[model samples]
Target: MILIAESGSTKCDWVLLDTLNDKRINTKTKGLNPAILKKKEFKNIISDNETLSEYKKEIKKIYFFGAGCNTSKTKNNVHSVLNSFFKNSTSIVEEDTMAAVYATTSTPAVVCILGTGSNCCYYDGKSIINKSISLGYIVMDEGSGNHFGKELLKAYYNYQMPQNLRALFESKYDLSEKTVIKKLYQSKTPNKYLASFAPFVFDNKEHSFMETLINDVINLFIKNHILQYTDELKTVPLHFVGSIAFHGQNYISNQLKKQGLNAGKFIQKPIDSLIEFIKKENAVLQS
Candidate 1:
């Protein structure tokens, strides 16, 4: 049996496939970013996840792609937790950027991730060659959910938002300055807290103010991430991965078009494509 997982700061999606019987099981659990959680906490996260516990013994090979898995220290910390769970299974840990590359296309392209967080890289059809330094939500993540959510909160608090929208925001959430500040400063997952407001933007998308806000964030993303790449990398189409990019396809595409760039595929999740890639590679090996 093979278990493949794709995780961000918010959640982890797992696909457990029994190759011999051709059976597949899908499950979801809380997000586990090694950079954020300590080894003990990471272990607790896996233990707390009911799905992982049930499939713990059955899984023979584990492929984990996650945010914050890029660094050697974080990778080792995560690997240790997985190793403890599936002692009999071989585990491979990789960064989420590599997952995006394999999920999108094999050809060279500019790959961008606009999920709970944002990241961008230049792929040379074989490997990631260059990457924009993701300064996290506090300073960067320009086009990410948290970034947009922060902007929304700013507009609402500053009294820049239209009255109707402000009323809607107050109706849906606690717009109290104290609550907002507490979440921003004291919460363990502040990014997720901020990103929770993105749904408001998506729900109120038709409004001109919302439209302009979305466009501005996307434009900044293009300028800071994609446009910073060399001309050669920019020649091909730019691809996107994550929920934010997938749902805001029309707006993102329009923004790219304005800059004379073509938008490539938008994959909301990469585990399906990652599974297909592995199966194809295995089939080739057998042949």
Candidate 2:
């Protein structure tokens, strides 16, 4: 049996492939970002998942692709935790961008992730070359869920948001300064807390405010991340992976056209496609 996982800062999706039964079991768990989470937290999260715990010994191999696993330190941190839990299994840990690349294209292209956090890399058919080092959600993540959430909060507080939208936003969430401060500064998972506000923006996207907001964020992402691969964009398509990119495809497409760049694909969840990609690779190896 094999376990494949694709994780963001907010959530992790797992698929257990049972070759003998020719079946797949899907499960969900909270994000396990080695950069943000403690070693004990990783063990706790996996142990708390009934499905993962029950099938731990049966899982011979584990492929984990997630945010914050880019560096050797972070990758080894996650690898150690997984090996401790899945005693019989050997784990392969990699950055989330690898999963995005595999799921979107085998050919050379600029792949971007716009989920709880944002990142971009140029996959040159065989290797991932990241020009910009992501400083994480605080200093970076231009057009991600957390970025949008931060913008919304600023607009609401500065009285820049439309009156009607302000009313709706206030009614939907606790906008009190105390609560906001506590969540942003006091909470362990501040990135996830900020991303929670992104659903409201997506839900009310029909509004003019949302349209402008989306365009602004997408433009920043293109300018900062996509444009870094300016030379490559002339030949290769820019592929996006994650929920924010999935929801903002139209805006992204329009923005790309204005820059004279090509838009390839928008994948909301990469786990399914990543699973198929791995299967094909295994088949080719065996053949």
Candidate 3:
């Protein structure tokens, strides 16, 4: 058996693949990002996952694809926590971007993550060979949940938002831009706070301004990040993952095709491909 984890900035998806039977049981736990999660949150997630102790003991390997584990320092921190619990198992840690590649065919393609945060890479199959900017939450993370939320708040404060949408925002958050600013600037885990408004975008999909807002952000991500990976303007099959990619796929994919980039498959979560990968790989090991 193999244990797998795919973590974004906000949460993680876990699966225990019983290689022997080719069955995968799914579970979800808290986020595990070095940049976003403190030691307590990280420890908590590990504890809850280890609650599957029967599976934990039976599992032979653990593969983690975690966001914000970009540096050796970050990777080691998450590794330390995971290793403590899965002591009998082997653990492999890689950045969340690589997980997207693994979620895809592990081929030479553009693998993107559009979620709480957005980032892109040109996966040469063997490795994610190169990646574009993930300039943190402030300047980048375009085409992300937080990005959508930020736009929603902007429209609300600027009075450009439609009345119905504005009312929803008022009802949900009940905070003015000034209050939001104070909270965002003065709070901890500000990214989570920013992402809080993302639901409003979906709730207000009928509003033209919301469409424009979504389009602008998705376009910026394609132009800045995806385009940067284009090799001599040759179109590459771009695969997308995460909730933002799932929800805003039409707008995001159209914008990419408009620029002559071939938009390929979009998978909301890596769990399916990950299970398949482990099952297939484990078969070879057994044989």
The models' CA-based lDDT, in order, is 0.88, 0.93, 0.79
| Rank ordering of all candidates by TM-score, starting from the highest | 2, 1, 3
TM-score, each model?
0.96, 0.98, 0.91
Please identify which of the two predictions, 1 or 2, would achieve the higher TM-score against the true structure.
2
The digit string of per-residue lDDT tens for model 1 on 222-256 reads 89888887485547768899999998999999998
CA RMSD for every model? Answer: 1.3, 0.9, 2.2
What lDDT is obtained when candidate 1 is compared to the true structure? 0.88
Q: Which is the better candidate, 1 or 3, if ranked by lDDT?
A: 1
- Return the clash pairs for model 3, or none: none
Model 2 ranges with Cα > 4 A deviation: none
Which 10 consecutive residues of model 1 have the lowest summed lDDT? 228-237
Candidate 2: clashing residue pairs, number: 0
lDDT of 2 by residue, 1-287 (tens): 88999999899999999866879999999998999999999889989999999999999989999999988999999999999999999998999999999999999999999999999999999999999999989999999999999999999999999999999999999999999999999999999999999999989999999999999999999988899899987788889999999998988999889988878899999999999987777678768
Candidate 3, residues 1-287: lDDT per residue as tens digits? 78888988778888887766768788888667887677667877677665456566676788888889888988888777777777778888899888888778755787888888888887765776655546688888888888887887777778888887777678888586687877799876677678777877866667788888888988888877888877823745778998889888888777877887767788898878877776777788788
Instruction: Report backbone clashes per prediction.
Output: 0, 0, 0
**Cα RMSD (Å) between model 2 and the true structure?**
0.9
Q: Which portions of model 3 miss their true places by more than 4 Å?
A: 176-183, 232-235
Total clashes, candidate 1? 0
Candidate 2 residue-wise lDDT at 232: 86
